[model samples]
Target: MASKHDIPLTGSSVNIVKKCGPALNDILNSKFGCGATFSGVDFERDLSIAHQKSSYVGPDRRFGVTLHSGVEVSVWKADLTNLSVDAVVNAANTDLQHVGGLAWALSKAGGPQIQRDSDDHIRKNGPLLTGEAIISAPGKLPCKNIIHAVGPQLTDPSYISSAEPFLEKAINSILDRVKTNKLNTVAIPAISSGLFNYPLPQCANTIVKTVKRYYEGVFFNIGHIPKEILLVNHDDLTVQEMERACREILAPHLAVPNSQTTARKTRSAAKTSTPTVQIANVCLTLMKGRIEDQPTDVIVNTASPDLKLSTGEISKALLQKAGPEIQNAIKNTPPKGYVIRTPSYKLPCKEVYHTRCTDRGAHGAEKVLWKSVSDCLWLTAASFYKSIAFPAIGTGNLKFTRKESARILLDAVNQFAQNSTQKMNVYFVIFPSDHGTFQAFEEQMKWLQAPRGPTPEASEKRDPFPNTRTPPPQISLTGPSIESLFEADKWLGHLFKSSGTIEIYNNFIQHFSHNDYVQLSRLQQNGVSVEEFFTAGHACITLNGPSDEVAVAALQVEAMLCSVQKDFVAEEEGEMLLLSSAGNNVPFERKRVDRSTQEFKDKAAAFHKQGLRISKLDKVENSTLQLLFNLKKNQLQCHATEEMFQRVPAQFCEMVSHVGFHAEFAPPEDPAYGEGIYFASTAKKAMEVWKGKREEYLYFVEAEVLTGSSVPGRRGLFLPPALGTEPLRVHDSVSGGSDISVIFSGYQALPKYIITCQK
Candidate 1:
């Protein structure tokens, strides 16, 4: 019989009972005088209630899998201090401060005594190095003891080179404590990920692997094993990552029925060689050498899901030879299970296909590997690449056995060749150090070539002496282009000297006006060359220069036209004296001419009498007056222009000039849309906008036709071209449609009229 007080306080309390059933009962009865009896009913009833309350369960009771050494591992998303295990491991800094993440939370929940014990240990031991751990009594936590483990600070560049070994040592030290104390159950959190900066996936894989190895007696003496190990984390992301790691590394070993028998079979199979057989129009060859040294069209580099190249062996060799550009390219693209192509740099191959097949866990390992190999084959065939080579994808850091890796790779290649229409030569290149893997592949190849069935199509076309001749050195015309170099190194501003050209035309208005020619002259003075031509109601302007120079020239021309239009409006309303002094000063030098005629003096005096004061005036041409003025009553005036009007209103031809230009550099978009149009104050901003739009549309400049026959009232209205006139056509590769035209709605009214066509 059991009293209500003894019926386990919570789920954690029930876990304690389940973990140390008889031992816990005896301790409680003797120490606290809470007499509790245990039976199948009592255990089940209490466990069910505790589960309903908090959902905590012991590892052995939770996951029904047994390790080789009979130890069971489970993952739980729960607070470390609340777990009712023999001990909980804390990822502690060398100084052992309860500062952040798991360490901080554990200290707060477990009371100050945990910290006090840690202080005492630190005082005696100086400071704990990575891979060292000390055990202290758990003050208020449910666990019996706390293992403060110092793991490497992976964020530190110096420690990154030795992160794995240090991580392994930390796990081993914790296990050492557990074995010495003969504890049955323990809970651990992901070490070094919070402030230490170890990557979550790598941390998860390393921890699971280290623990698995420990349980298998790789680190400890035989017959010493903890009954249950719980990989616990309070954070959702960390828990998910650990769960995946366990599934991939531990679950496979536990789930496999008759794993020992399977191992024995695999070992026996590796001892014997298999004959090779051809499946389709593809021949598979295995050779032992450095993959980077192979003369193939492309070589495959096994990368992590993040496309992080490994630090050792073939991957390291590839990275060293390929330079940093390859890594940068990989980062710009999407990672995961996709295949990426990059220049091989100094490698023997023309290109390298970087693919990710690691960390896929046990169940998805085969599927991920197949997709990687299949994608490589398909891409090679589509590109007409004759030969491609592969390394043992997951057999290295991922811990997949060589035998299984060979089988999966060979099967994928075989299946692809059978269905794909293109023919290719596939080679499996292995390094000399990987002799076991090489033997495994050799055996599989031998078995495949065994004559058990009718001769296959691939066999008929196979070269009799395939290994005798080396592939001829491929002629590589694929050196780094200047465009690629510019893309790679944008900070090299001198590279902007490269130039391109585009031509623009408009059928509505023919010929460049005096103002248009003046603007073009100004551009030529500033490094841009603008060629203008006109014939029978159609005008064209060809602009060529460095990208920045062209952009600046176009912007200045737009500003000048806009200034002219404003002046025309002011002159027509008899408000020409209202031009602001702050408006754009003419870029070209202006010459002043004395106006002494009696009629001009009379008109000027009359304008002054009407409360208008012309602050400054200059002659634009023979009869034109460029005036800067303001109202006497108030300073109501625009600031982006200082020039006023042309003398003859009807002769003020609203000339539409179609202008085209190209830039070598692509600029980012401007946050301010119309920043530089009025004053050319935002030249950088205008260039950004131009380049951003250039990505999608072909650009043109169109000036409205203000002819002698135009009606004064309909000056700025939208007017179509003559009925029989042909529409101007501009060819643009960026836009999809062939005959898409973008009209400038208010070309006459706007200071700058920029026309764009879809294609």
Candidate 2:
């Protein structure tokens, strides 16, 4: 047992004070009775605290070191940063700029200056040795300084031995500098996990433990000096897996304190409400009990989708309890199906709906479970039913973690029950054998047992509309025609903003290049500050103009209007409202068009008049688009995708054309990095194309190093700003823009009836 008098530092800052080295160690060890053992050095005589205020470290103290005499341990604490700090540890090789793990990413993100800085440092320091530390400029990083902490160099025979300790030393050296410079935050990439073959989990554990040990005593005082560390991981899975592991690791530390021991024990006892599950033969013994006699609706936890109407299976034990008729019905039914005998002799209610939980192990089953639960609740409520019984779902199937499943079911039930004004009760039935399930229920009951927050009636009784004291006032907006174009831009912008790659369907997006803008003078002349002109809620229709002409005009003016609207959004910031297109849905092709039809003939005649004659149109409509496209020499035939065909009617067919423009954004390259020669030209082209388009279309930019390039034999990726009729082809043969068809914007915007010679 440790004595209270012997403990110098008692709060959360213990580990933090220990990482700063001798100064913090001596005072804490002496005062706290911590018998820390320092390797090779006599810490008792050498250690001294430079600054001590009742063992309270300031929040601005980003790093610290302390020793605990009681435990005989030395700990180091340093703040981790989200942004770059004094030194960002890099996993680098002698050839620093070349592709590897952290090195490649750092090089890419930092731009070309990083390589230059690295080269300059190496020239002065010679080649860096494993465990060696040096300082350099951050290049393009947010940090002003860069601490190049080298790990062991890899060779054929693994240099694993020197790698581990070097990592530790590198970290220590950085922390040492942090204290010296009084710098607060630093971001750390998972060093040596890539190409070098360091195990990720082990590396993660080491980094976390080192940070934990160092900052044991000093974290609370680190003001703007971030004590919080954000681990940057490129891999999404790696981040999630590591996060889950960390959560589990921290769980033991956050366990309930002893103050609630007695209460916990009581709750634990209450949790064991059910006894062992007993299986008995099918039999029904009904006693006299009115339907209204039951206190509330009984909800059985189930693993099936349909609960209310489906005749779900019942246990042999339950069958014996329910007797012959119910038992017979249950035996023949599928699992989780519910059979309600209205006005039962044993309980209250006009009907009984049986439901089940979803099976955890069932592949592709969670969606089914969610859908089933929602369906049952919705169906039951449709009949104006007040309450129903439900069971613990997923307990038997183990589909969900106990606490998680309990919360989900209870939330769903509570939400459903509240949609009615009548009284509602959700009775959770527990089986004797399911101890874990029972524990979850008991835990929920505590919150359920509370006197409800703010309003108890809302908690106990269902109310269709809790805040129904006053009717919601109506709101409306009216704006100039410019607002309609703003809506179109917003709608298209959202579609393009979608995650992953976006592809435009059919000739709808291809036919027109829209540049929607109100002239700067027109905007001011109209007395519209761009706010009133582009407000989202305002529905502006071209009341007297031709719909097609108006739409085309809106498309052309959208960019200028969006630019204006964006400024307003920035100015208003918090006050901006949402705007959606009234009736326009994404136009997707629904059916394959007959290329030989009158419409096709008319289009062919129009194009022929323009000197762009089709050679062939593919009869088959493959891929997602039901488009009928034909190749003309330097010209292209365009049609709608399946989605567009289905969404847009034939009346809107005129909206489909052979010309349009779209744009994409990317990070501009640094000249200092020496144009990644192989990819530079393509990237330039891509930038040009993206900047030129403002309408709906599929666009792509790829940079690749082609064979036999004049600049260097070295390889690099290339970017080609190209438009495609479909998703970008990943096949290597089509390197860069080989597979993409670059539709000429100027040519697409040309009128269809202009006959001219092919120059």
Candidate 3:
């Protein structure tokens, strides 16, 4: 049996391997892989001892010991060092190629050897199961080893749903490896945000909460392992947001080191005979100096106001207090003024300059404040030509929003360079948890790389939806029925564009099934027919007999369906139109399912239990649709299964093939299942409507035959009975005695508000 120390404080230990039981040889290999190269007896006990010694001695808390001191208790305010660790955990997927993210940066720093070793190991081991760990040498890194832990696969339960579990596994595995290796320090970056699709703030909370919990009570179980944990700071929005959240969550325990000794030494070492001047406000200091001769260095004094208080409020007050320091620096300068030459901050020879600024109120004002500060910095630069990089002007106590500050600063720098002879490269000298500011700065820089402008030679570019390969599908029909449907919101866009139906289906299962929301889709691809798509489930439809018997018959049919209803909701129209409008003026109300209502809440719960789904019609405007399914095998949800997809009917298949979608679904295997498939068509609009929702207007599809006989639009499936389904399909040609009626039904609406796809 596993020892008690192996259990994390969160409850049970994570399942490291999902598919296979370890054999004797497997154990031997694992031991060898662990590099138990030491020549000695009593290996097991020795290893256990070593593991115990390396575990972190996190902050004391009711929740439990944590992986890092501040990660759990939020006791520290500084960014943790990255190089000081036995191993660094890189949150990675099955494919380990370093793209644009923290993974990519780590890969770059670690060098090609790291990637080579990773690829080789993965080749030998295949894809890593969620919560599994594999160790390899750290290559160029300062750390001895790098433990690549695959969190959760983004295939099912969506990345969001599986995020917490994956994080739990990652935290435990890291702790276990740290203990076994007898390493005292470990650095970890924010996991699961980029491409993994988990929300930033939630991911942060999970990491901090889980690691803290692990360090608390669980350490004793691990033979009283005492260690240090460092949560490496990141330069991204995710990390900044995490820091903010962590600060709030860890408020009770947050404490500042009495750095009197350190500060005194720092001050003494850099001692200048000149008098030390301090400021209590950034705005007053920045405004103190003449715009023409701003101080070269703006020092922000973070000293407390001689009172006992919390860290957050103190950090917040620091920048404001530093403003007077800038004014003093300016006053102490020689009588001779620095030559002010340009609008940009760069001057002739003086290298760096710093200034204080503030975050007074809303984001709009902050932008303008930072811009002016940068303007002065540029003027200083122009006076000196080439100056050293300086800390940002207002980020300290002014409390300027990071994103806005970065944008304003970068913009000012760019504008100053327009005509100035002196150019200055600026650095923000950002404090810890300023990743959001860095991200904004980086984004602005990246945007500068692209060419700007429009031209007559760009006629091909005039069309917004260019036909690169197969253009995204479009719906040509007009009128009421085309206006209603639900698109699965922003997060699921990648899933819909995925190459194959199975992949899309799997993605949906992973992302939405565990959540309260419904995952809706229109056509399988750009051109796939609705019939082929609907055939995947057992679709039940209710009809309202002739108009003469409409009320009674419709009521009877609805009652019958209601009796068998395990979970459901009523809707007046199809969601296809809503899907199409997602890119345009898609009405918001019809698109989103109101979760506050008891009916929706109940239906949501029912959808979870029945292995089925529900679509309701409260009031039909001009159209409606509904469906019920028995999801026998969640193929799209589970790991690859041997079960085959049920072969659809011949006619349906023919229709699908005729209006075929251009798509692919090649699994990364010998006989790859389904991977990459693209469907092309002008019929995409119909597909969009099929998967979306329509609230404001009716979507209608009118048709006329060769004899000029006009028929009512059949697309308004959600219309009210008062509109009369018969009137929807009526023929304009006054024939001798032909009676016409339209086929209409209610729809199952998906949540539109939460998942709207931005145009």
Question: Which one is best on lDDT?
Answer: 1
lDDT of 2 by residue, 1-759 (tens): 121111122221222222222332222222121222112111111111111111211122212222221111111122222244555666666434424345544555566777787777777768766656566666676666666666553333255555667666655555555556565545555555654455666656655555455555455543333333434443322343344434444334444543385355764465543321100100111112222233443323242343322233333233333345543443355542333322222334444444444466776444445444544554443333445545555545444777655655554444433222122333455544566666665554344323243322335422223443422111111111222223323443332232322222221221121111212222223222222221211122121133222222232233223233333323322221111121222232223234677755764564455344532221221211111121111233232211100111111212121111111111112212111211223222333322323422211211112222122111122422223443452211112233222221211221111111111
TM-score for candidate 2, residues paired by index:
0.31
Candidate 3 stretches with Cα past 4 Å from truth are 1-82, 153-159, 224-226, 236-251, 255-759
Range of the 10 consecutive residues with the lowest summed lDDT in candidate 3: 43-52
Over the stretch 1-759, how does candidate 1's per-residue lDDT look in tens digits?
Answer: 111211212323333333333233222222222223332212211111100122223332224356878888888767676788899999988877764456766776788888788888879889898799988898898999999999887535555657899999999999899888888988888888765678777889999999988887573465568898888875445665787788788886544443364355664454442223334446577766788888899999887656666554767789887777778877786643458888788888988998776553666666777778878886676455778999988788777778777767876786566444334678887775566887777655644544343322334423222343432211111111222222212211212222434333322113234324533565575467887665322245666876555533433333333334444444433432223333223222223223475644643464355343322223222111122221311222222322111111111211211111101011112212111111111222223233432222222222111111111111122232322354543111110022111122211111122222222
- Ordered from best to worst TM-score, the candidate numbers read 3, 2, 1
Query: Against the true structure, what is each candidate's TM-score?
Result: 0.27, 0.31, 0.32
The RMSD of every model to the true structure, in order and in angstroms, is 30.6, 26.7, 26.8
Please give, for residues 1-759, the per-residue lDDT of candidate 3 as tens digits. Answer: 100011111101011111111111122112111100100111111111000111112321112223333323322222222364577777766656543244545666677787788778778878777776667787777677787766653433355664688777877787778777776666666666544545656777777777666766465566435355655543323434555555555553643332453344443332221111111001011111122133333222221222111233322333234333433443343321221121122322222232323345745445445445544544443233323333344454556555445545554454444323222333333433444444444444433322242322343232222332431222111111111111111111222222322111211111221111110111112232211111221132222222222222222222222222211111111233342232222122222346668856664464335232323212111111111100111211222212111111111221111111111111111111112211111112222222323322211111111112323332212322232356664332111112222211111111111111111
Q: Give the TM-score of candidate 1.
A: 0.27
